[model samples]
Structures are given as C-alpha cells and as structure tokens.
Target: MKYLILGAGPAGLTFANMLLSSGEDDFLVIEKENSAGGLCRSCMVDGSPFDIGGGHFLDVRDPDVTKFVFGFLHEDEWDRYERDSRIDLYGDIIGSPIEANIWQLPDKKQERFLHHIAEAGCNRGEPMPEKFTDWIEWKLGLAIAEDYMLPYNRKMFGEDLDSLGTYWLEKLPNVSYEETKRSCAEHRPYGTQPGHAKFFYPHSYGYGEAFIRMASALGDRIHYNEPVFSIDYDNRIVNGKYSADKIIVTIPWTGVREHIGLPGKLTDSIGKLRYSSVVIEYVPENMDTKAHWIYYPDPKLSYHRILVRHNFCPGSKGYWTETNLTRFDEDKAAEEGRTYFVNEYAYPLNTIGKQELMKELLEYTASKNIYGLGRWGEWQHYNSDVVIRRAMELSIN
Candidate 1:
C-alpha cells in the first residue's frame, strides 16, 4: 500500500525509514522546510554550527530505537560520554536533576526543604492534588515547590504552574525528608542521584547529522521543501487529490487541523493549545565554554537555555567561524557587543487545557487512519528517542 507521510521531522522520517527498511518503498515523505530535522536542525553562524532549537543529547535507553537511529554511525562517529549537565539557580550551580541536589540550596532553604519532607512523609495516602500547585505541594512539599519548582516551571512553560496537568509529576524523582537531609549532611552532589545520569552524543557532526544520515539512507524517497497546504479527508487524500492507501501525518496538530478544514467543535478545542517560542544564539568558537547546556530558570533572560555546540563535538569549532545559526544579524550582534548566531523554536506548552485539546486531536486523527506522532503532532512533550520509538510502534502496527 502507498503511504504519504507529512512533516519530515524525526517522527515522519522514522516512520518512513521503518516502512522502507521493511521493503515497502511506495511511500513519500514531505517537508515544508528546505530540509528535514525540524526542531533538531542546526545552522552555521560565523563558522560555528549551533542547534537552532538547543542541542539534543541522544540519551534514549531503548536499544531498538537507539540501534535504528545510530546503527550506521561508525565507531569514531559516536561518542559515549557521561552527562555533565547542571542548573543555574540563585547564583549557585546546582547539579542537574535538581530534586536530588537540595544541598545546593542555602542553609535556610535546605532546612525548609527538610521540614517539607517531614510534612510530606507524614501525609501518606492523601487525596491526589487537583492542580499542579497541589501536586507540587504533595510531592516536593511547600518549600521546594515555592522556592524552586514553581518559579522554574513558570519560566519554562511561560504559564502559571497551576494550569499544568499533573500527569508529568510522576517523571520527577521524589526524596524523603530523611533521605534529603542525609544526602545534604554528607555534602553529596545531586548528580549522584539516579535516572538519566549517563547520556550519549555524536562525536563528529552535531546530533542533526544522525538524522541527515537517516535521510541519506532513504535517498530519493524523501521530498524536502514540499509544504502540504491541504488534505481532503472527505476523499481520504492529501493536498487535494494526492492519493495514498494510508496517511501518516507528523506535522504539528495545528497544521493538521488547518489542512483538514476541521469543524468548529474540533477547531475550537485545538485552538486552545499553547506553545513557547525560543530564540537560539550561536556564538563564535572563542566563546565556547564548559557547559553542554545551561538552563535559565530566571525570568530575566529572554531565552530559557543556552548550549555550547563545540562541547558536543570538538570538530564543531571550525563551523562556528563560517556562518550564523543563532539567527542574530552580524551587524546587530556587533552593535550589541555580542558574537553568536541564534535560532529559535516555539515549543509546545503542556497546559491542562492544551493537554485535553491534544488528546482530542490525537483521538480524532487516529480514528481517521491518519496517525499523529512526534512532539508537536501529538501535542505531547517528548525527546528524540521517544518520537522515534513511538513512530516505529505506529508503523509496525
């Protein structure tokens, strides 16, 4: 059966690759941009290549997806490194996975967190919180939630924390009062805590290089710069008469709703979805620092994160001098006494209303045989591995 895949990002590309590798070659992949990679694409600025949507580390623990994406990387092409990530909070560099590094907090804040832990431990089997606030209080207690979690989330999501659904709370690591106090008293860093401590990255090219290789494998099967403006669901076709036995759409759900001429019921709900726009700045190789990625939870900074491309691959230094990927105009950057290229993306914001809207969109699209996968398409937050794995599952089923 012929298949038409929309949006040549990771999800669409993964689905195409899975089907083609299975000896099913009658599928077409369409991308609106000049090339693929979507949010994961990198650009050159002043000879340095900067990931427009921040650097992506390939930390997926799933072997099937890992092998599928990086299988072609020669020994020298990939680098296996332990994660050296950190968070900047209140003039202090706290080890990443902030929950475990309570010692980084000032002594007063530490004592407050300790008290919160005590309270939380006593309140077992309480009714689940209704809002993100309640969940934070229940999980991390009042102190950490008010001091760190609340502010950090507000900066990241660009929305009130209470509006967020509590589904994501389970992903966070929880520590009891005694555990936190003991760890702090021992002066242990948060990095020693469990989950996602070790991650891998490509050694030579940026992470986008992996996707570029995948696209190369498909060769002529993939079509770039083909923005699908419309889909005719009444006739079960796309772009007004491009026929396919099956359609796999990986574009943002917003695009899908617009293409299919969704009715008022669906369109109204879909409109509630929210997203955060990013501005990436790629500086000169001379500006390279020790950080792989820096998280800016403080609201003062316009950008939420800053990443150093050279940190991922030493060879990337050469590219830093040739072009500007950070989207900052050379003359403008000079005027502002800055020297980096910047690129940005509007990330999907997972507000409760938007979450519900996304669920409706996914269910509606799935019912029509037009599977929606990936972060933007499904309106769910996901890393690269999650997108690839989900697409593989969808393609196989």
Candidate 2:
C-alpha cells in the first residue's frame, strides 16, 4: 500500500475518501474494531438509533465542511433543525448561558443573576485567571459560576477543574456584562450560538450512518478487526504485513505508545498525555421535549448532559445520557438494560504544556513517515467538521 491509515474514525475515513476522490487508491484503512465508524459508530436498539460515542451531529458552521459531509448522504436522507438546547438550573428549565437568558427566570432570580453579571471580573477589568476554575468565576462571576459553570464543568472535566488551562475557553461562548445586561433588558439572546446551533442529522439512522456509507464506499480498501500490534517506523511496515510510504495515525497518542517503536524519551512523553473519558448510556424517554439536548449542572446528577434522541432521531422515543467515566455506575447502567458505550480517550485535555508537547511529537512524527491527525492524533478537542476538513487538506497536500 502507498499509504496506511491507522483508524476508521472521521479523520481516517475522510482522508481515505479524499484519496479515492483524487484518483489515488493504493491505501488501506485499518480499524481495530470489526466494523468502521470509530467512536461515531451507531447501533440499533428496538428501532431506535444510538450514537454510542455520545452526541455527534454535523456542525453547519463551515459551508465547505458541511458540503463535504453532506456528500455522503442524499438530500432526502438528512434532516436539518435549528438547535433548541436547554439548561436545567436547580429545578428550573431555561435557555443556556444563564447570563443571556436571565430574563426567563423568576424576577428575583433574574435580578440576582444580573447583579452577579455586573460584579463579574470581566466587567471590572480584572485580568483573566490562568486556571479554568478561577477563570469561570472571573468570566461569569461567582453566582453563575457556582450555579452552573463550575458544577457543570466539574461533572464534565472531573473534580480538579483548576488543572485545566484557560486556552480552550476561547471556543466557548463569551459573556460580557454589556451584552448580558442588554439581553436581559430586551429579553433577547446575546453573543454567538454554541456549536450545532443549526445542524443536520440522518432521517432513518444515527449520525454515524454517513460514515458507514463512507466506509462502504471504500470496499476492500478498509481492513477490519486489524490492530497495528507492532509498527516498524524505520521501514514503514505495519505488523509485518504491509509496507506503506507514509502512515497516518488517528488513534490517541497515549494508546499508540505500546504499538509504536520510538525512542524511550518520546514514548515516555506520549504516556504523559492527559485526556478525559466518558460513558454514554441510552435510555427510553416517553416525554416529548422540544429541546434537542439539555445540560445538567447540578452536582447531584451523574450525567452532565442528555441528548433528546427522540427529537432528532426518527422512529425512537429515547434519550442518551453522557457521564464522566469516573462517575459512571456500571450496575445502574446494566440495570437500565440500555446501550452503554465507553470511550477512554474522549476529550483531550489542554494542560499546561500540552500544546508544546504535541508540537514536538507531531514534528518528530512528520519527519518520520508517520503523521498525527484529528482529535486523538492531534490531541485537540476538535469537532467533526474541523477534523474532516483537516483530513481533506492533508490529502491534498
């Protein structure tokens, strides 16, 4: 094979398709699982489709990226909807970013949150804190931070929220005292919409259906149930089987250490990579909620968020809960008898030195015929569109 791809996820499969589209086909896509689709894989349960890797929808932010993603499925096969995401705040349901939607809350509650926003550090011209925990307080004030941001992030990123850096916050919606107050005064949404504000989903299948179609298009070019047990990077050989001129690794760097042959220093550094894990559990929901997904910030709840699958997916009156792997209850999950999928490397953490470390490792690998791509490969918490666009760009280069 001229090229060897080490995963069948969004990054790997997209790269494979791009290669084929360019009239180049001497490549093999290897997936450790018996099937393709990687973490985005979906399964059927009593006529309902479950996204085992958690809720992944085609983001409509980038026209080019969305166009490329829409190519796999026909127009009639997909459905688009404006995002109606909600937040559960201490028994009260309101729009997300309590700062902007404070008007929806009770009069007293609205007045209190407005006061909190007024006293926020961002309004006082205070410097942003370095830690995620303190930054939350500084960015949105102590009230909203404690009420929603802090506890919700604790459920999402685990107990020591301080360990996380503030770099990733740039991607999230930024709240300011002026916009927030104006929003509350006028009862309108402020700032930008979160990802999937307007998105697409498959009509009859889960979000993974398009990737499955992409995999099917590749035919024999994809190798299933094949793990790269050992890689001879010196010779560009994989498991003593096939040799390729270049290899693209889309798996987590932490998991790839044992399978790769690298210097002790490089391998040890790879082991130090930090990431978060999540367990997705699907359950039946007879309630017909208009919201596509709801965020739970209460520390009492195990799940940080739940996707109303019935709203987006067809033929199913169910929802899926996402919990941090540390808090997931196996017994309860088994009792639910619903679908449960665990991904050990869910969100790559933006630690103190993660950027520098990834830069060094990627530079080293590129020098050798091995390259890292996508979320795990690049250790970036990128959405599907960004991952696919990166893959497409790499294929062209």
Candidate 3:
C-alpha cells in the first residue's frame, strides 16, 4: 500500500475517505476492533443506543466539516438541536455558561453571581493565569470558580488542576460581563456562544452511525479486527507484515512509542503522558428533564454528568452517567445493577509540557515517514468535528 493509516477512528477514516474522494486509492486502514468509529461507537442498552465513549455530537461551527460529514450520511440523517445543556448548581437548575442564566436563580444568588463576575480579573483587565486552576478564578472570579468550575473540573480531571496547561482551554465559553448582564435581563443566550450551542445528531441511530456508514463505503480498505501489533517506524513497516511508504497513526502515542525505535527520552515522555478516563454507565430509567445533558459539579455526586439520552436519542429512553475514573468513584461504581463501559483512554490531558512533548515526538516520527493524528495521537481533547477537519486537511495536503 502507498499509505498505512492506524486506528480506524474518525481521524483515520476521514483521512482515508478524503484520499478516495480525491481518486487516490493506494491506501489501507487497520483497526483494532471489528467495528469502526472507535470512541464514537455506540452500544445498545435495553434498545436505547448509548454512546459508550461518552457524549459525542457534531459541532457545525465549520461549514466544511458539515459538508464532509453530511457527504457520508445525508443531511436528513441528522436532527439539529439548540444545545439544551444545563448545570446543577446546588439544587438549582441553571442554564449552561452559568453567567448567562443567573437571572434564573433567586434574587440573592443573582446578585452574588453578578458581584463575582464583576470582580473577576478578566473583567478588570488583568492578565490571564497560566495554570488551569488559577485561570478559572481569573476568568470567572473566585465565587463562580469555587461554586462550580473548580470542584467540577477537579472531579472530571481527577488530578491537581495546577498540572494542566491552559493552551487548550480556549474551547471554554467566552462570555463578556456586558453580554452576561444582558442575557440575565433578556433571558436568552448572548455573546460568544459555547461550542455546540447548536449541533446535530443522528436521527435514529447513535452518532456512530455516520462513521459506520463512512467505514462501509470504504469496503475492504478497512482491516477490522486487526490491530497494529508492532511497527518499525524507521523502516515504515507495520506488524513486520504490511509495509507502506507513509503511515498515519491515530492510536494513543503511549502505546506506539514502544514498537517504534526512538530516542529513549522521547519515548519516555510519550509513556509519561497523562490522561483522564471515563466510565459511561447507562441507566434504563429516563430523566425527567428536557436537557440532553447536565453537568453535575458536586463532588458528592457519584457522576460528574448525566446524559438525558431519551431527549436526544429519538425513541430511546433512560440516561447515562459519565464519571471520571478516579479511585474515589472506582470504589463506589454505582450500587445499581447496571453494567458499564470503562474507557481506559478518554480525554487526553494538556498538562504542563504536554504540547511541547508531543511536538518533539511528532517531529521525530515525521522524519521516519510516520504521522500521528486524532485525539490520542495529538494528545489533545479535540471534539469529533475538529478531529475530522484535521484529518481531511491533512489528506488534501
């Protein structure tokens, strides 16, 4: 084959699809699982489709992304939704980007939230902090940070917030104090919308359906149930069997480092990469809320968030919970008798030196005609749209 792509997830598949669309057909894809979609795959829980890899919806922020994805599955295959995401603040149901919906809170709480936002360093023109923990207080103020972001992040990340870097946090909602106050008075979203403010989902199937269709279109090019057992990166060889002139790896670099010979320290940094895991537990009981998802920041809660699956999954019922795989929750593991999916590699952490470390690793691999792509490959917490966009962009080049 001319090119060998590893891990048939969104990244690998998109790259291959782009190649075919451009009339280049000498590439091959190898997947570790029998099915495609990787983390985008869904499982059937009592008939309702559950995304075992956690909540994934396509963000149409980029028209090109919409065009590429819709190419595989028709536009009619999706149901568009204005994001009905909420925050569970104490016992209150606050609309997401809490600052924009504080008006829904009691008068006292509203006044207190405004006070906090008004005094936030960002509102006062102070420099943003570098550490994720410190940045929260600086951007949203101590009150909001303490009340929600900090505790919620602490639970989701299950790590010292100081260790995470701020390079990737631009994904957070960028609400200004003026827009926030206007939103409170106007009772609607205002200012820079958070990602997925309006998004699309599969009409009848889980989000994975689109990817599965894309994989099917590729036919025998996708080698399912066959994984990259080993690689000789220097020689552009996979499993000591398939050889290609160029390779794109979408798998986690942590595992790839071992098979490929690299300077020991670079390999060490790849191994030392930190990540967060998620346990997606599907509950058959439906939640009595219109929200597609709700963020629960309370450390007391067993799960950080709950997906109101029935609301978004067409005819599906029941909800699923996303819990960080921290030791705290492992000991708990929901006393209820529902089997759960444990994804050992979930969100890749952008901690401290991770960006620089991955850069060096990718640069060295490129020299050997090997490339890394997707979430684990880039070691960034990229959503599906971004992942697909990057893969397509890479393919066209």
Highest TM-score against the true fold, candidate:
2
Order of quality (TM-score): 2, 3, 1
Over 1-397, each residue of candidate 2 has an lDDT whose tens digit, in order, gives 7899999999999999999999999999998888888878899865888888899888778887877877888767889999898899988899875666777887788777878878878779998778888888888888889899899988987887777788878655556777767777888877766668798888998888989989998999998988767677677777788789999989886765254467777777787788889999877655567888899999889999999988888768878899999999888778967578898878888887788888888898888879999999999988888999999999999
Top model number, lDDT: 3
lDDT of 1 by residue, 286-385 (tens): 4334666656566554455556566666666521321222222457767887644333235666677676667776687667766768887787778888
Q: Which candidate do you rate higher for TM-score, 2 or 3?
A: 2
Q: lDDT score of model 3?
A: 0.85
Which segments of candidate 1 are over 4 A away from where they belong?
120-126, 189-196, 256-263, 285-291, 315-346, 353-356
**Candidate 2 to truth, TM:** 0.95
**What is the RMSD, in Å, between candidate 2 and the native fold over all Cα?**
1.7
Computed on alpha carbons, the lDDT of every model, listed in order, comes to: 0.69, 0.84, 0.85
In order of listing, the candidates' clash counts read 28, 0, 0
Return the lDDT, model 3, position 268.
Answer: 82
Candidate 2, poorest ten consecutive residues by summed lDDT = 253-262
Query: Which sections of candidate 3 miss by over 4 Å?
Result: 170-189, 327-336
Give the poorly placed runs of model 2, Cα more than 4 Å off.
Answer: 171-174, 257-261
Clashing residue pairs in candidate 2 are: none
TM-score for all predictions? 0.86, 0.95, 0.93
